[model samples]
Target: MSISVHLDRITDPIVAQDERHAGSSVRQPELRVLMATRYGRLGASSRLRLLQYAEPLAEQGILSTARPFLSDNYVKALYEGRSRLPAVLAAYARAPALRAAVQEHDIVWIEKELLPFLPALFERALLGANKKFILDFDDAWFLRYGGEGEAGGRNRLVRTLLGGKFPTLLRRAALTIVANETLRDWALRAGAANVLLLPTVVDLDHYPPTAMPTNPVFTIGWIGTPVTAPYLARLAEPLRQLSAEAPLELLVIGAPDFTLPGVTCRHLPWSEATEAAMISQCDVGIMPLPDDAWARGKSGYKLIQYMAAGRPTIGSPVGANTTIVEDGVTGFLAGPAATWADRLRRLRDDPPRRQAMGSAARLRVAADYALQATAPRLAAAIRSIAAR
Candidate 1:
């Protein structure tokens, strides 16, 4: 679409004439945005929250320049179980340059905290209060700053120094974009002037609902990075039990070496190109998370991806998973007493139920969580913040 046509959809002729009369042109200058994401495309949080919207926002006259704190090498090293001390030091060294870069753009979109381990006061001094920046959070990273049950002296020091940092940033931000209601409520409690609940979404074009592939073995699939791979351990016993009763295999993507003691496992490296098709191969998708502040902050993008692929999901009824899965309708939510094995067995026995739920899950994603559904709102929000 042409820029003029885009402008016409958003701005009426009367408004243009009014602007012209007020000594301003009908055509506004393209809004330049500085996207300070924590990591490059390798990082899922930054990829889903900020980078994915860049092209769509650009088409709407909002151009963004993404500056990642950590490089792709940092992500690669982290995933490969290598020490990231050098990468951390390098990222900290490079962070200060962003303070000066803030003045070059109309609006700054910060993915999370500007500086890790630093107080908000220091960040304020570096960036200043004059520049308008949008603060975004897809996870409750603040929980790391001495949350509940931390008794160590080092934890106390961290809490004292950085506990209030997120609140300060939230209070001062021109707009705060969060991935789920848990984070949104946090921002509101922090006195954020504006809060937008923009869930992490998938591109429907990339994740088209296809007919479920026929497989001799029923596959229970999961995709996540190493940082989140530990959560899969929650399902180990359940999966092991299910493996005996059903012709099942655990298909693990992203975490290639993940395994279970009694269950058969197939691991595959995650690539953007294959993730959608990879998900479609599974009979069911699962996201198991502990019920904690940190887990509650998760955006449930994994569920969204599975739903978009026309696959039924079983997620822990914690955090955004509660909203993403429609319990008995679209997918099942494993509660505290709810056995994961029971849910898996039920879906395994009833292929028609799985197909019905998968179809409903796909429709749910298309309506609320797809990139096509949310991109316009994101672009408009960015434009609104820039205009202020």
Candidate 2:
């Protein structure tokens, strides 16, 4: 299951590796990295953290070669309510091509595993061939397949078959990159010696705030995939109560079919080009989640986007939300379903508080959560691993 890391680099003789960690700085004119993403750009996890690195890393002499297991169209299928078996099979079919291309690269940056629902050892050949590897995670994926969730709890077959691979893969990677402390702690517990906490970020410059407030109604927004649309319902009753007293509207981007009874829900389809502009116009952003293990693994990218757009956010005090939102300073964090209504009312009634918090949010993003702040760390991690 293991081979000399030097085999993949070139025909150079074995170097003096008598005493050093696997990742040591070595000069290579150019480093080719095969980034095997679980899903294409439409996938937030892979898009923000891994795929976005292509151009930036190249400037550092690290060439990125992306091999997405799931096509963007496949995401369209999932939302269309089509059977996923075909797309899942197609991903598996590309295994050989992806594996064949691995040998030519200096390192394989695994954005999640090569394929889902497959045994961990399915990638044994790559390890056997001495391919250098790095693992990255923005979500608590271990709980998705291995912990409590619909995928693991109800679908016993999938849990039985594909669940155990993540821990095995975590232990095998040359280095692990995590988006938050929760996942970093899990990787450390999984026996990952080399782990990096690289938070997911937004390019603040690209998401400049709206020039002026022009919306017909004061908008409280939320953005995410349909799968997470249910969390929006958590705000339905709260928003309904606030709506009775305030001139507010709810914008749910990325979930055109989503509806919240008792609340005015404006569902808009999500597109890369329009995402920033759409979020920038919102007065406040909301991310409501039921306190659960799977929800805890979430990176709160929605909050990051809203904050980058200079919109204050209100989210459940869980996972990265606790760190990203500075409670009353950046945005409000609701403690329970009971307090949701009061929180929404405060933000809606006090425009001054909303504007101040939103400004703080944008400043926070520019200072710490900007892509400019974290991309270099990623380039360094990739460069160091490739050097090994």
Query: What's the CA RMSD of model 2 in angstroms?
Result: 6.0
| lDDT leader | 1
lDDT of 1 by residue, 1-388 (tens): 1111121132323323433443334454688998989899989888888999889878667889999988888899999999988998999888778877888888889988777778889878877868898898998876767533232225668889887788888878887888888877777777887777788999899987699768879999999987788899888888878887878998899998777799898988899889999999899999999887778889998999999999999999999999899999998999653378889889998989999999999999998898877877666666566655
Off by over 4 Å in 2: 1-28, 147-160, 212-216
Instruction: Note each model's CA RMSD in angstroms.
Output: 5.8, 6.0
User: Which stretch of 10 consecutive residues in model 2 shows the poorest summed lDDT?
Assistant: 3-12
The TM-score, computed over Cα atoms with residue i paired to residue i, of candidate 1 is 0.90
263-353 per-residue lDDT for model 2 (tens digits): 7878788998889988876888889887777677778889989888888889999887898899989998997766878777787767778
Best by TM-score: 1
Off by over 4 Å in 1: 1-28, 147-154, 336-338
Cα-based RMSD of candidate 1: 5.8
